[model samples]
Target: MFPQSPSIASASNVDILIVDDEPTNLRVLSTIVRSYGYQVRQAISGIVALRAVQIQPPDLILLDIMMPEMDGYRVCEQLKFNSETKDIPIIFLSSLVSGMDKAKAFQLGGADYITKPFQVEEVLVRIDYQLTLRTLQIQLQQKNNRLREQNERLKQEIEIRQQTEVELRRSEAQLQGRTQQLQQALDELKLAQTQLAQSEKMSSLGQIAAGIAHEINNPIGFIYGNLDYASEYMEALINIINLYNKYYPQPHPEIAKRIQVSELDFVLKDFPKVLKSMLVGAERIRDIVLSMRYFSGYDQAYAQQEDIHIGLDSTLIILQSRIKEQTNRVAIEVKKEYGEIPPVNCYSGRLNQVFMNLLSNAIDAIEEKLEVVEEPFHPIIKICTQLSNSSKQFQDKNTQWVEIRIADNGIGIAPQIQRSIFDPFFTTKPVGKGTGLGLFISYSIIVEQHNGQLQCNSEVGKGTEILIRLPIEVPQSLDVSTTRKVKIAPSSLSLESDIGEM
Candidate 1:
């Protein structure tokens, strides 16, 4: 059934083309179409109908199959194949009404077929129905074109995201390279500083050595002169004793009593004490040289082991200058509740960098929180670590992860912007105050480099809880989609090798 179309604005809106060998059929269709407010063009043969369409296309075509020179089937085929005239609905109007004929007409691309001696009502119904179908086909084609355009645009958008990921990886590689270079320079600087401090300390020892040499050399010189004088006195006394023994061998007891034997013994003992003091002064110089050597050989290489505890301590050390009070008097206090955690495989220096960034951000948030400081609010920070139960929580029948959570009591993020926090260059901080890459870099290290998970939970005006879950033993390769929520087993964490250890 066709819709009873409301009358168009003008009779010329729907044009009808009628083609037949009989002049009577043309007259009949023209009259019927004119009543429906349609303009009509008459053709004596199929050749004339095709020529007429090329000259002036019509909305509908009434075709005759039995004609001279060319038939309706040939005309319909030629018209349907042409891009310009293909949309014009063609209907076969003929006396040859066999089933095979109707099927052949349609197969040749005819919109409809009716007997030449047709009812006016039946002809009108078939014409309206064919025209309506043509309209629907046009709409469907238009819809398909629109969908194709949308898919192309979506494809372009995906390509842009993939390109962005590639650029991000390049940027991360550059940053890592620069960090390694800077670390090397810092190590060199520390070495120079250690050498400088040792030099300063040894310079003082040089002065002390000069002072000891000046003060003790005089005493040592006089002590040696006194020993020489005592040797002369001993030689003179032996000569006298020999002479007396020769003269009075029997009276020796009387002569020995007369001589001062006790006084002579005192001189011998005091001379040895002076020489002993000189030897002790020489030994003091050797002790000072040993102390200087020990100071010069301070640890210069990054040979320190992964000290989870020391990592945190170094973080505190780096953040010390930033934590002060009002008027740049901001001080951050830290609280810790450490638990039994296996040593993680990590570069302590790099981990220290991460910890320092986090600690500074926390302190900054607190300082800003007390902007209009009525009274000094103590900016408190808490650093805690514990053995994770991630393995117990998400048992995958294989491995487990270690969970390290960092919490801060500061103005939190809005829910709408929560998911975007990990996005590159996305930050809530004032412009120039943050690079927005800190968290992104940290996220990549944990999630990309270590095959870990980084998640945040926060509400506006409330604090944030940042949880980092790292696998105990990193697998040979990682699939983000597959191992996103996996746990690191306690047994696996036991493969703790201090990356920095010698």
Candidate 2:
């Protein structure tokens, strides 16, 4: 008899199948397996074991190798081939103890093997091990599935984060673009306001100039008219006196004494000279009044074909007083290199203003330099004008351009300050002495109104040159009649007094 197997009361849920041709051997295995608290089923042959497994599969199969019709190897192989029974653990129990027999049983998918008269305890241990391994494999598969799920969720979260970051960056860029646009609009508004103020000031000055010119024209007309008649009358009186003196060569003593006392000969000779001098002075005054009218641009209501040289000359004449010798310095010399250029179509008054500003600035620069220089310095302002061909310097080949350069040997601007010289409200002059709008307005007049270019080149300790390039013919689309008009004001008639202060 086989030694009794240990009792396993807690393994009641496990089921075992005992298969053999001999009833006694089957009975012995069943008793031992049942003692371990397992449900036991018996089969007499391999065919019977397979049939029984088909009906109800067991957790473990104890098989005998030597059978009457079929062997344990064939039974195990058939059970292993069935999908429903393949996972069941099979143990071989055999009287054939050869190694080949054991190997054949294992090759048929047997989990363990025992010879005849095997210990019951060894059979129980093998069954427990195989069941434990199967349980662990199932648990590992569940853990792997959970890990896969977690990995997929993490990937989704990462994608969401990346998309959110992209959206955030796009929003920031849009905000920055809007901010820049707002800033640009604000700057433009400020510039327009400044220009409007400047225009109003110029307009008021022009109105004042027109009124003064009208007032002075009436008196000047009569004075100029009467001077010619006065000269004729004086000549007639001198002739009468000459005839009387010739007729009365031998005068009475009383007459001779009276003539000597009065210095009659000296009076007769100098009287005509005094009349000539008076006539010359009146003519000079008339010319000055005319030049004042020209410099004021009172007649420029629309764009007209006019000589730029005429405008320059009138401006110079108005500024003559400043150019003359000052108490502290000698006269400032002005050199003109005017080229043979045709008349240009432009607002003559505005052009005069540009010239006035540039010349006044040049004079101011020279005056400032005079204060600092120790050597004998003769301040010179050189103005040159020429026709520019269509080259790299000029963009339009169809249109003719005139280039004017006004240069001054004075306290030149530094490189850093040169860039901002044309900006509104930028100036080097003291607070009460300047308004800082002269150059800025000049630049706007040339570049914006006339579609011209204004450039400045300067070096410290050397000099400054302001270059202006303007088209000779105004564009057909630019309607001068519709443009803002600036007239000469009485106060502005004196370029040196008005613009020089600016």
Candidate 3:
């Protein structure tokens, strides 16, 4: 049967020791402590209690203040001094009834003190209280030790992680540097490839242009040379016929009839006009051949000082067929506002290629506008050029720059894709219409090779303007370097290629 104490200590098996001098008192306390579900041991004196406690400490101790040789205070002091048994809760059960005696007991680390003639309820309650407190202290100490151990392990792990992070960061930095170097090499390789392809294509075009010019110039030269002689011979024959009519008015009826049948008077009047028209046609052909040679620039392969307007005019002449009236749209009107800019030192052929590309794009833009819009619209491309300075276009004052602007009234580019227009293989034109390398190559030629700038400004319904600024005297040994950064204006346009223009 359990003690009816109704205390927390009764739930667990607890060890308790009762120390007293009286055998009867020890027996009585032992029964009560045992009934409370505690394992009780008895020591008849303080000395025996201390010995028993040293052997195996109990959860709590009930010590008596009056005992032979060693009193409760001395025993508690001894127990409190020992590190192993200091935490054991001690309750004093004594016959001494003085205030000093209870005070001394408490001073020596006694948890509770009870006088003689103690009620069983009071003694058991004190014992239960001390035991419960001892159990709580042990649990708290255990938790504290575990927490300390976990804290030490966490600190070690954190140190290891920090060292690993340092090494990883060092490796990452090395890898990033290597990646950047590799990327730079790749870009240079791609640039070289593009330049080679461009050179081959330009060479082929120059060869074709020169061949055609040679083929046509020979026949056209012969026809042009004979036209004048033919005209003079016709005049001499007419004079002889007039003289014959004057000297011999009476002609054979057969000759006069033949003359009447052939409409001689009308032929005589229109013959000079025919010669003049033919002469004009021959002259036009000669001019076209000259323009083709000039545009091809096969002879001027290297950088040289040349009139930019000449190249512009030559490109326009070559593109005359495209600018002519189309089935869907009227002839595109080319408005040239050329300034009195001096000859610019450049690769004339390359510059001409750029001009051809830009002009062809303008025509395409106009064609696109015509296809989508139903309203009557006259397509126009405006080409403007002038000398600019640092204040004008943010160039060096010492170096004069020529600015060329090619504008077209067409379906302008949307704002969102404006930044990507210069990227390689990017295009807005339908599959077969564009090759997407025109603007990219043009950008590379102008910015990288010639050290020039290309800029675009546009509005959706209004128009697009492409501006090119180049130094009048380019570097003598200009090497194609890295691509320059371009700052696009607020609104811009996309570009497509006419690879056939070359």
Candidate 4:
């Protein structure tokens, strides 16, 4: 029904052009090009071929060197010179059979020479190879473009990741630096607290020393006066013994007996008085030693609660020698409002140290403002206790609190200096009279250690009032959400009213 299709025309869709002057040659070349699956364009002359190439460029050109109007040499040169069609390879198809002919074909810019008696297989193979090369070039170009895009994207992602890592490192370094700073500050604070405890201990010893000196002085004075009288009695007794020895030089048994007996009488009369004076002096020394041993026995202060009133009793024993003489110097009144509460857990030594500071300060204030130049006001030291549910100091509603109020009718703290009094090394006493650590240490123990609050309320020219409120129990559960902790040293005494007073 239809003309049989040629083998080359069914093979591939590559567009190939054949240029030749003879109709037979054109038909034959077209057939050969089509057998390899190429789409063939036939131009009878170089002019027609150029027009065909301009319309649709072939992958390769099979050009005939000889033509009536435009030869293959001119066509090849024109096609090679034009940028748009330069890469279309043109192989010359010529009938010239000479070395000169081949040379001329090459010189005319023909890529290859194929004589008129060309084998169809050879022509097909050449066309297929050239077309394959073009396809490879297209693929290579596309691959290169893709690679460039990927490289750029990779570079951008790498830069972003690097920046993020650097920022993270910086943040981590800052956090580490802050942690180190906090640790150093905590270390310094602990060292400072240790030094303060040592200083307070020394101050307490100093007060004890002063008290002892005053106490022993009185006994020494009495002993010295009694010795003077004994000296006089010894002089009289010496005269009597001398007279008796001179008068009774004869060795008589009865006389010796009478002399020994009279001497015994004289000795009995004076010995008892001297012995009593010496015994009193010895007792004073013994008491001083015992008091020092008792006060110094405690280990360095930590937190624990002792009976507040019990501490008062021990402090009274320590201050007896100092206050005994000043008894008439002031009308002193003592009142105790002791509660049935158990011994509070607090730093026993630190608490005693606080009492010593407050009591001494009160004495000094009262003494300073005493209207009777030589006498002091009726100094009354009142200690009162109230069981309050002071939840302010504790966050738990179940916490039981006890309030201890120590009020003094003495010169009060000036408003301007009241705030600064709690500061370490702040003192109004003469240089050696105070070390300025008492209230500061007290503040640390009460507020910092016991989780209590210390407050001072006073007015100038009026009396000072100090109240201490403390929770009896700790909360059932506390959140340990923070890594930082306040390390507390254990102690036997607790500060219920561990308050700082100015």
Best by lDDT: 3
TM-score of 1: 0.46
Model 1, range 449-499, lDDT digits (tens) per residue?
Answer: 466666666555445556666666654433322212222221112112121
Model 4 stretches with alpha carbons more than 4 Å out: 1-194, 197-294, 300-305, 371-376, 391-396, 473-502
How many pairs collide in each candidate, listed in order?
Answer: 13, 3, 0, 23
The full ranking of all candidates by lDDT, starting with the best, is 3, 2, 4, 1
Evaluated against the true structure, the overall lDDT of model 4 is: 0.65
Scored against the true structure, residue 262 in model 4 reaches a CA lDDT of: 75
Please provide, for model 2 over 234-299, each residue's C-alpha lDDT reduced to its tens digit, 9 standing for 90 to 100.
789889878988898888899889989999889888887987887787777777777677766733
lDDT of each: 0.64, 0.77, 0.80, 0.65
Candidate 2 segments exceeding 4 Å error? 1-164, 248-285, 295-302, 388-392, 395-399, 415-426, 430-441, 479-502
Per-candidate TM equals: 0.46, 0.67, 0.64, 0.40
Question: Which 10-residue window of candidate 2 scores lowest in summed lDDT?
Answer: 489-498
lDDT for residue 433 in candidate 2, whole number 0-100: 79
Task: Quote the lDDT for 408 in model 1.
Answer: 62
- How many backbone clashes are present in model 3? 0
Root-mean-square deviation (CA) per prediction: 18.7, 9.0, 7.9, 16.9
Q: Which ten residues in a row have the lowest lDDT in candidate 3?
A: 493-502
Relative to the unseen true structure, what is the C-alpha lDDT of residue 416 in candidate 2, on a scale of 0 to 100? Answer: 70
